[model samples]
Target chain A: MDTVCSINNLARCLVEGGFSPDLANLLTLLGGVVLVATIPLVTVIFLIWIERKVAARVQDRLGPNRVGPVGLLQTVADALKMLTKEDITPTGADKFIYNLAPVIAFATVILMWAVVPFTPLHIGADVGIGVLYFMAVASIGTVKIMVAGWSSNNKYALLGAFRTIAQLLSYEVPLVLSLLIPVMLAGTMSLQGITEAQGGMWYLFIAPVAAFLFYVANLAETGRAPFDLLEAESEIIAGYNIEYSGFKWGMFMASEFLHAFTAALFFAIIFMGGWWGPFVQEVPLLGALYLVGKTAIVYVFGLVLRATVPRVRIDQLMALNWKFLVPLAIANVLVIAFLIQVLKALGLMPVPGADIIAHLPMTVVMLLGNLVIIAVAMQVLRNQGREEKMAQEARMAARQQRVVKEVRTPAGAPVGD
Target chain B: MLEFNASTVAFVVMTLFILGGALGVVTTRNLIHATLYLILSLFGVAGYFVLLSAPFLAAVQVLVYIGAIAILIVFAVMLTRSMTRMSEILNGQWLLSAIVGAGLFLLLVIGVILPTWGNGGLLDATVSAPSQVVIDTVDLGKALVDRNGFVLPFEVASLLLTAAMIGAIVIARDDTE
Candidate 1:
């Protein structure tokens, strides 16, 4: 007689209605699956409209308003249009793999929701290794890109896939490294466990550097602004999905948009004390509201950044990941690990399940540690920038000197022009 | 005593994926097709790890094998112009490879299977039921770093990997620079 509409309660109701226990359980399980799967798919339609509206606002233009109220039904109209569009398979394409790529791409994102804790009592599956489950499912996306690129029988598609893979693979290093911070703090990889561990204090306050690293890496992972080289329309002509059309192409777009919002949701859950507002325990549904509110804030921040920032060059993207984010992330993890040990030895470590006030000392110390690391990293980056600028100036001076020498000689051209 | 359960059906499906993908890998003429088939086979192995109730191992399998290694293999194949399309599936060293593969398979059968041939049961003696044991990931992490556990070998393996990475960088360095 539980009031909550949870799977267990539903199963119990079915059992009381004369169904066998196993059959009731099976039906409830199926219903839960449908519920979990459809939530993302349904929400993604609205997410698209929101993304367009936000982007429009950022660029000082009105977004879709022709369809329903504030263009709310625009995504639905687009979906219908996509449905009626011609589905074309290019000549010389690997038809089977080509067709399967979009399905895998879209399915991989949805699979991640299987472990997401929407509320305290409403997780799809409380997998033991939920964080790793996310990482594993995301990794499958690389395979989909490869399959799509290779099977498309288009050079642009292949090249796009190659660049996208490089970006995705490189960012995954920092992404996984930053993910370790929360896992270490929580002492568990399960998303629910992490959320529960954040009850006392959000990890964002304890380890803002890790949160930043995770956010940046995820931005690159999702191919958002400054890292959207995967589909640099001016360069590779739509990249990996260039050969796709109709609903197949639409699926890729949906997954991309959905993946961005999913990253935000994970950020909220892991770092921002997901569903942990006041009275969340008393009203479980309030937890869902709090989670969504936090997620929307993060998601809108991402959209604004996307609209504002220009895309980075491939070389710059690689250099940033390798030289900047990866080292910073590694150092952040090591520093946090060391600080935790120091706090433990000093007997200043907050006990598990302590209140927020009890966590203040540890939070302050960890926050100071993060600020120090950030300071040091910023100083190092400034020095590197100065050195590179000096070298560029010196090279320019030498080039000018050579030009002058060539002008005086008039017979000999520049040696290495 | 085996019941017709969900896991049994899943196992059958996973076996089909593994065997079918492996067969496709060796039989396909297209190198990219072969790589895709190899990914399918690796995914099947990950499925088996899940069935074994080692979700951590399964995630690692997908993350490392399919995500990193398979992508590397595909990258290498794409880089080589002539490797994408193979004129023939078999090479002149097929006989040698076949002999080596068969010998290794036989060795596995002897080394692994022969010891437990007539035991209480093959699977029962090897793999405990999922409900029988629960190994938390925290314990696994502790075991990797514990002084009484595998700390030494773990550090050595990490050092070896670092050295190998440095070696790769050196070999791939541009001489023109």
Candidate 2:
């Protein structure tokens, strides 16, 4: 056990202790996986509690103070309650798929943890295609929603699934486009590489528009407000998981909370420089603390937004994605790519592995490029808003004229006819 | 006889996924179930790409095929009435369709196996082992845009996709508006 400091050490120790090499390697790999997987499972309990407290605070209420000191054990109690509750299966529901959906929903989120770089030294797998792997796993989450909705054998569930698919599939375009920025800047799709590359300066400074786009798209991706049309309680009940109950429903809820946190974690890693802070290189464990701190900030922001913002209508949601985010993301990518090339040609770009000071010139140029795009986009939005307001006023005026005419002609008379 | 190695075990598992999923797709009475099965099959192919050491390709396969294509198919199935379940598995042209399917399968088998057989049967191809060949994703990205590489074909493919997207929008647009 003393040799279990790292997976490699553990495997080596086992091999030296007379265990077969293959068996030792397999055991260590399994142990590493279980260790990584448990972090989310354990953290999600605290996250749910934190979310409730934040929401309660924003809405002027105390949240679960009775469960334990500061309501620390509230999520545990809720989990117990959920477990003891009766599980119901609707008549005519596809039982296999209904059972499978929650599992997939929970598993998909956990699978994403495989690629998350917690520290410079700690990662689950550090796969070469980490970013794309995250995208792929996130996409599978849609299928889980679809399965849940379809298997529930309810109209509301089906409608919720449809909305979920539309919202998820639409938001994914901008999400992927925004993700490319970090990949391009780092010249690697692996999350660890991206984090390392951001050591000089976080991509948030270099490509603020892309960061903004990623944040917005991530909010939509996680089905959080104001883009949370999928489960709009007033309209679709509980959405895809409407038919689920007991621990099954708990699984869906747990996954949703965890997914939101994971998105924040990825956002922090991609844009805020994951595991990179003063003295972090000397102490790898401190890097984990930095990652957690960054994730917490982003997560709290998401919770506050969710608490404050009203959910957008389905049409507005679609319009925002296709009309605004998608186009803006595309333009941002193109501009950034062009700027990188120009900087390189002019010898202004920082050499690979340069320090923060060396990155200043290139970062400044890219930041200005992003600011210009943002300014232009704001102007376009302002013009569009004014035009829409004028159209509304004209329509109101015409309606007023018609009403006045009707009153002058006497009500119910055939004067217009 | 196949070697009892990790790769062999993984390959066997992937083969099961692909074949089982394919069988389930055709045999299922429900359209939604069939689509799900198709996704499973596609996912197995992605697994094969991973096994072949092309993690980038594997990820793209899952993203594009299982994520986008299968979801679109599911949406389409849900949109059409009475498409989820069918009472009859066979249509009037089942016999003709079966013959076509069989022919296509045979052609695929011959095309895949013939070239490999000339060397040392299907199992002993000249392709290097996955562990022996390491291709960095950065190299893959460069090759896509490199002047002497896939730049022309890549641009052309993207252009074709753009054209197709515009055509779709045009067809779906409300002419009265």
Please tell me which predicted candidate would have the highest TM-score against the true structure: 2
Interface RMSD of each: 0.5, 0.5
lDDT of each: 0.92, 0.91
Tens-place lDDT digits, model 1, residues A2-110? 4555555898888778899988888998999999999999999999999999999998999999999999999999999999999999999999999999999999999
Candidate 1: stretches off by over 4 Å: A1-7, A404-417, B120-134, B172-177
| Cα distance off (Å), candidate 1, residue A351 | 1.9
lDDT of 2 by residue, A111-227 (tens): 999988888899999998899999999999999999999999999999999998999999999999999999888888889999999988999999999999999999999999998
Clashing pairs in 2: none
All DockQ scores: 0.85, 0.84
Candidate 2 stretches with Cα past 4 Å from truth are A1-8, A411-417, B118-124, B127-134, B170-177
lDDT of 1 at B43: 94
Candidate 1 TM-score, C-alpha based:
0.95
